[model samples]
Target chain A: MEKSAGSVGKVVVDNISKSYDVGRLKEPVLDRCCLTLPAGQLTVLIGPSGCGKSTLINILAGYEKPDSGSITIDGAPVGGPSSDRLVVFQETALFPWMTTFENIVYGPTVQRERLRDEIEKDAAGLLETVGLREFRNKYPSQLSGGMQRRAELARAMINQPRLMLLDEPFRGLDAMTRELMQEYFLRLYEDKGQTSLFVTSEIDEAIFLADTLLLMSARPGRVIKSMPITLPRPRVPSMLTSTEYLRYKEEALDILHEEALKAFEGGSQAAADFVEAYEERETVG
Target chain B: MSLGATSTNAASNKSIPGQQVGEDWLYRAQRALTTPMPYLGIAGIAMFILFWYLTTEYFKLPRFVKLPGPVEVWTEFTNPDPIYGTSMYTFDYYKHIAWSSLRVMLAFALATGLGVPLGLYMGWKKKFKDYVFPIIEVLRPIPVLAWVPLAILMMPGREAPIIFLAFLAAFFATTLNAMLGVESIDESYFRASQCLGSTPWNVFKRVVVPGALPDIFTGLQIGVGVAWFSLVAAEMVSGEHGLGFLIWDSYVLSQYPVIVIAMVTLGLVGYVYSLLIRIVGRSLMRWTQKGQA
Candidate 1:
């Protein structure tokens, strides 16, 4: 795995703000949220629920446009979807009608401006890389959730995007499957060396997957902390058990914990009730 | 082998379900025979036929009131002209059956060809839906028979009403099904296609059509059934050479056997058409049984 001590490339986020129309009124989701995703490195965005981590990803993916700020990919203004940037959603976005092989090959086949034989070879190689070569003919529903994620990974990779945005890709997987998928993703990133921006709630996942972790605060979300992970390349699960990993995890957790408490106190009935119940139990103890 | 070992093997074999090799024709035959309705139906039909033969042949009732037995109907099927007399235009029962089947096939094809694409487009793109769906909704609830007067007024000839009625029967059911099929398709599939750089046309052709096919086929089966029903009603009014017309003409002349024959023909044609539609649907959606992606 290639290790770069300094920044790889520049991702400029210039005063981006977003608001959603909840019924008739506009509810502010992100207020001038400014953060850079270093190119050629994995950047993990962490925040409390409804903190606009997903909204940021959507803006980056060209699915949504921010009201004020602009996102530039390598100095070009991000306008809309292009082959240069890709997104892997938490849900398995595989086409139900297509087989695993077909789903993987779809990108190349549609972009048939490329040579057909070359596209086929690339898809086959990707299937092998994802350990799904044997089940290439199988449909998405036949595969386990982890395997489906692998297919989604293969489909996203087939396009060979410069920037890949993942929105909690392994959030719903069982613990064992989640670890397996994380390792798979690590290997993929190492092999492909593509810049990725991963949005996740799990502090450990952020620590493990990111070269830099961008922690954002609650609604009207803005980047509160940007912690550079000085962890070495090709970091394994065993590295997660290290003191450095634990320390980084604790730091991230501390930031997230503060945001969680703030969110709980700030007039959210469900959150307030939860915090009150917990405090009551603590006082009794 | 040891006695315990032998017993254990026997028990295991008993616990395991038996797998049949090749086609189990005997099992299928047994299942067919054991079906509750067919046995009861056969018994009821036999009793009816016996009563008809006894009452008509033995009682010697008035000729108009007392119809011929099943044997007479079968003989009329073999040599229809003498039994049905000159009033019935067709030489045999098979001729009328063939004519009705042909009309149904043509009408069904026309209805499906027109309805499927219109339904797909209406269901898929929201912009087109506002314009197209309202029109379909207005036209759909109106009965096929209700269209008869308008069809007669608008159409230049007799052929038009028959075809119009057949189209009416098929169009609404097929359109409804097609729209529903498209509506029910997993949206993620379309989104995935878009992400893969699929053009709108490719998405419709590859993703939308196939995803909606199971529902489309269901609509087609229903549409064909409705088409046959409409054909019968249409034929009664405007048909010159169909089973419906044959029934009407025979009833006018009081040739009861010919009327019964025409009724049987209509039922048989409807049954056969439905079976064909089902077979086609099953084959088309064979992959669905396996599972979704």
Candidate 2:
């Protein structure tokens, strides 16, 4: 595919905002969020549980639209879902009707007709790389959970898209299996190094996979902090206890904890202060 | 994306050698335990026949005395050109069966051809659904009998109206089931297809049709049953020769045994038609089996 080795998977978000009409009132979810995901590196979005992280990823994947602002992927403006941008859903979305081999080649087969044999060969190799060559013909129903996630990764990766959006792709696996998947994914990423936006609520996972981590605020979500991880390439779980990992984790946890508290408290003190100030100003006038 | 043979995605059809195979007696025992339905069914029928005989032939109780006994119907069915005659011969029985089967098949095929597309399109395209839904909702609830007069007036001939009635009976179930089938598909499949670069038409072909198949087959099975119900209704009203017509004509002639025979024939054929639909449904959807019983 001759993808440029560096600085090409860049994503720029310009003051994107979004809200949902949660029945009675429109609830603001993302408030004027701006982010620049540097090209050819892994960018992780992490936040409190209710921070509308999926909403942000959905917008970036072009499956959703923000209320305001814009997203550009590698200098091209993003719009509704295109092959250039793909999303890995939180729940496994591999078609159960399809075999591992069929699913991996689905994107390529459906997108274009020429070069089918070439794509088939690529799919076979991808299955091998992901350690699923033995399970290629099996239906998704037959594959173990971890194997299904790996097959999903192979399916997405085969497209060679400029930007990949993963929303909690490994959230449900056991801790051991999750770690293995992260490494398996990491190995694949190192080879391709495509620009990716990986969303997770877990701090350690973010630090392990991220080149740059964007810490998002709770409700009315937006980027509150950006931490650059300077860990050397080909990361490992052992880095979790290391001093450098601890420092980054501490800073992120601090910001995330503050946001979580603000959300939990409903920011009532600030609201109370505003009401009191309004009454005083009216009385003085 | 040019990957080579060295990294093969060769579909492994491997089963754990010893783990996959259970002992033969285990399967034999399972079969023995589970296949009791046929025997149970035969026992139930025999008991019902016994009750019928005891009440009608031996005891000669109330209304049972007036009703034809199992022996009388059995003898009449076995008779060659016997007295209780709709048509006088055994070949005439075959004729009635052929005619009714032909009618049911024609009406069922027509209903499936028309209804499945309408249902799928209604589910797929929202605007089309909005336009068509009011009429379907209003018309679907009206019983098939209610359509008989309009069908008789609107269709060209007796056969056409009769077929129309049969089609009407089957159409709603077929259409509604197919639509529900499409709706039942997980939204994730649609999203995945979009991410994989499927055109809307391609999505319909690959995802929508296959995903909705289980429901469509269900609709067909129900549709065939409904067709049988309407076919008889139409036949009683206007049919020249069918099982339903035979039942009515035998009643007029006071041939009670012939009427019973005609009723039984209808019941048996209706069952086999539905069974045929189920067999086809299972064969077509082998992918959905997951090898489960």
Candidate 3:
């Protein structure tokens, strides 16, 4: 199958606010969050821990209804989970019962937007692209963590969704594996350029992958800053020490530190770790 | 995601080589049969029989002097023309075995057919559970044998009462475990299916059924075992022809070796049933074995 480049329209999340009922208390997570993912761009959502990135992703994916506001793709209001917006979850959700090939074919096959034979052919192609052709018959549990995540990516891409939501897709992998996955994912994103909302807590990752970087506030999160990353395409590992990458990193870390302090004042231990982690990274660099 | 393929998911501590996934089922079965585990299991059974023989046959302790020894039971079991009519060589013994097997089979089938669907719906929908769970809670705790008097009163014949008693025992176990199985699945799978544009029915078919199977089979195993237990009790109370009836009749007639023979047959048949369930469960849940190689 030839690469189908860039068909998704802009995704506008307009003032989405959400909270959960905890006992008698109403705990707000996302506070009137607003952002725009431009067509065919990799938009990275970076925030401190507990800043409700997953909640916003959930809202965007239509898995949960926001308390107020709306999400639109090409002027169509997002009401519920649909094939148009697919999410690659933080924890691997490859349907442990299904083999890698089955999982990749699941979305299109279930949606009935394409024929089974066509989907199977495309799935076979995707398996080769993801380098999982040899492992296609294996179940999720039998594959390595990185392989599962890659299979998840293939599963989402096969749907050809207008928007892709990734919630820290590599959160738990070792640092080395995480970097390699990021590059591998970056290559796929560059080739297809699907409009994406990628969530992460790592500033370096955000700078490495984002065409447009979004920084969210502490708790009750909303977009506090949006900046365009002018780095060249086909990002390389050596960019970690480049002046341009470091510049983006410094700005992101500053905003993140301020948000961490806000959350710390609000008595979040997770924010304390967030602040300390960046500080340690600063000293080491 | 990784080209290396060496690192496995954290959920599985051990990873079987991918090549093993393609091994033929019959080859694997042959290997399993040839393993040392079965021989060790046989040795364990032999030791247990030896202990029984020492106590009841050779030692003749006061507590066991009346109890029939393993040798006496074995002799009657293998005898072509035994004195007692309830030996393995006799048609009467086969009739008892067949009756007990048929009742247990009927009870297990009825309970599983009704219980699994009810349990799945109960766990899937809050309204359904609210309407039904309280009734189950109140009725489940009542012992199976306790239902005998009411069952006999409600049902006309000896067969109906015995089967009803056995059904009640199996039903509670199957229902509760199937419910627990549905509840045990991670929430993310449901969410993932929704995002992938699966219909509500598809979610139930693709997610709910396969996800709950492991627990459903567990319930079936326990349910079948409990059904056998209650079936025997019901037979002893009201049965005219079954292994339980044979044992009771032997006791009354002072046919001590026949009672021992009936008891051993029950154990053997029950063991075979449990093993059959486990084999079926393993085949249905092939994915679960990927990490255990």
Every model's TM-score on chain B: 0.75, 0.85, 0.88
Per-residue lDDT over A1-285 for candidate 2, one digit per residue giving the tens place of the 0 to 100 score: 333644567889999999999899999989999999887788999877667889988888787899999988877888888887788888999876667887898888788854977988899889989999878777788888999999999999999888888999999899999999999999888888888899987777899999999998878888999899999888977888898987887677667767776776775232233233334535654
Query: Highest DockQ: which candidate?
Result: 3
* Model 3: CAPRI class: acceptable
Report the C-alpha lDDT of model 1 over A1-285, residue by residue, as the tens digit: 333422333578988999999999998889988888777888989887777888888888777899998888788888766556778988988866556777787777777778867877888888888899988767677888999999999899878777888999998999999999999998888887778899987777889988999998877789999999988988798888898987786677667666767776665432343244345535654
Candidate 1 ranges beyond 4 A from true positions: A1-10, A267-285, B1-82, B85-91, B291-293
Candidate 2 lDDT (Cα, 0 to 1) = 0.82
Collision pairs in model 3: A147-B1
Candidate 2 off by > 4 Å: A1-7, A22-24, A267-285, B1-36, B85-89
> Tens digit of lDDT per residue, candidate 2, span B148-249?
889988999778988889999899989988888888889999999998899897788777887898999999999999999889988998889889899889
TM-score of 1: 0.83
Best-fitting candidate, measured by lDDT?
Answer: 3
Poorest 10 consecutive residues by lDDT, candidate 2 chain B = B1-10
The alpha-carbon deviation from the true structure for residue B263 of candidate 2, after best TM-score superposition, in angstroms, is: 1.7
